[model samples]
Target: MMFLVIAVISTSIISTSLLPNESSHIPFLNDDNFLDWKDQILLTLGCMDLDLALRVDEPPEPTNESFAAKKNAYDKWERSNRLSLMLIKSHISQSIRGSISLSDKVKNYMRAIEKKFVSSDKALASNLMNKLSGMKHNNSKSA
Candidate 1:
């Protein structure tokens, strides 16, 4: 029983540490899954760069005004769009799990997302913004 308890504790620590931290405000681009899983991060990172360029030279850092302003309806709409993409991404990941090679999986997912973007609701733009912020793309020189 004592051995079981220690093992469980150690396992919990390792697993929890391995899971993504959603509240860290760090972008998802640098994650192993993001790095090896797909090219979607590149698109997301590019969009973020464009959005920030439009806003100003620098990307929007966490601030009171920006955070409060993003609470508007447009923000909600944007968030929804990102969520939809994430859902689709999750599905793609599950579908290809342990079957497709990493590069192929990424390529396939990217193609699928491009298609989905055309039909996606615009309200989810905020979510796109959120996804783009932390994305570190292999070819991206902007950040």
Candidate 2:
């Protein structure tokens, strides 16, 4: 699922080629945009017809006695899982990329990404609370 970090030209002041097409305008995952990025990533994957991994659990690996339907399901899932991973990683910010351990499965990868976001959200709320604890509403003073 590892794709070389290559290419440039699109978002922010620096270029952004996160999605397959620059025109897709899917938000890249960054320190501040997990919520937005999450929605976009899901929608984008669905639009690309590659959300099979997200939609269903990985099917059991086909074996010598496996039925044709089971084999097909496994193949479909494997392809979707692989492409989903590539799409997901490509949308992540390079700076935050290293913090996440790579996963062969898209569901697992998404779970890791969500865990990071939840932790960051908690930290932000904690920081805000800490700041609030030190503040007072003196009607005469500016906030």
Candidate 3:
């Protein structure tokens, strides 16, 4: 079952490049929009069939006996990593870019962003809770 799923995903990634032009309307990320930008960027990566690059920590090393198969896997991994990095860099605003240099690997880049913005999941949850609690609800009926 796992092998079947991997095969289907591999096929999909290969065919993604051959499809007609599809615009990924990703929004640019700035200081004040990290959360929204993260959500949109994730969606864009999924649309491009490159979300796996961000999730994977490292690609499996090719075995010596299966050189050709290993080479193909390595090539695909490299392509996905490169595409992930490019997509992320393209969406970041100049001001934020000036503060930190992005890593070449997609996983590292994502970790860096998370570390800079939230530091920890607990902290992020607390921050969000505070924001939510501070909201002022105006009692007005709208059409």
Candidate lDDT values, in order? 0.43, 0.83, 0.76
> For candidate 3, what is the TM-score?
0.61
RMSD of 2: 6.7
The lowest-lDDT stretch of 10 consecutive residues in candidate 2 is 1-10
**Stretch of 10 with least lDDT, candidate 1:** 50-59
Global fold similarity of model 1 (TM-score): 0.22
| Clashing residue pairs in candidate 3 (N, C-alpha, C atoms within 3 angstroms) | none
After aligning candidate 3 to the native by TM-score, how far in Å is the CA of 34 from where it should be?
A: 1.0
Candidate 3 least-lDDT 10 residues: 16-25
Candidate 2 positional error at 134, Å: 0.9
Between prediction 1 and prediction 2, the one with superior lDDT is: 2
For 40-104, candidate 3 gives per-residue lDDT tens digits of 77877776677777776566767777679777877777788898888788898887766665578
User: Would you list the clashing residue pairs of candidate 2?
Assistant: 10-16, 11-16
Return the top candidate by TM-score: 2
Compared with the true structure, what per-residue lDDT tens digits does model 2 show for residues 1-143?
Answer: 12323322222323232345565577788999898888888877887678999989888899999999999999999999998899789999898888997899999999999999899999999999999999988789666
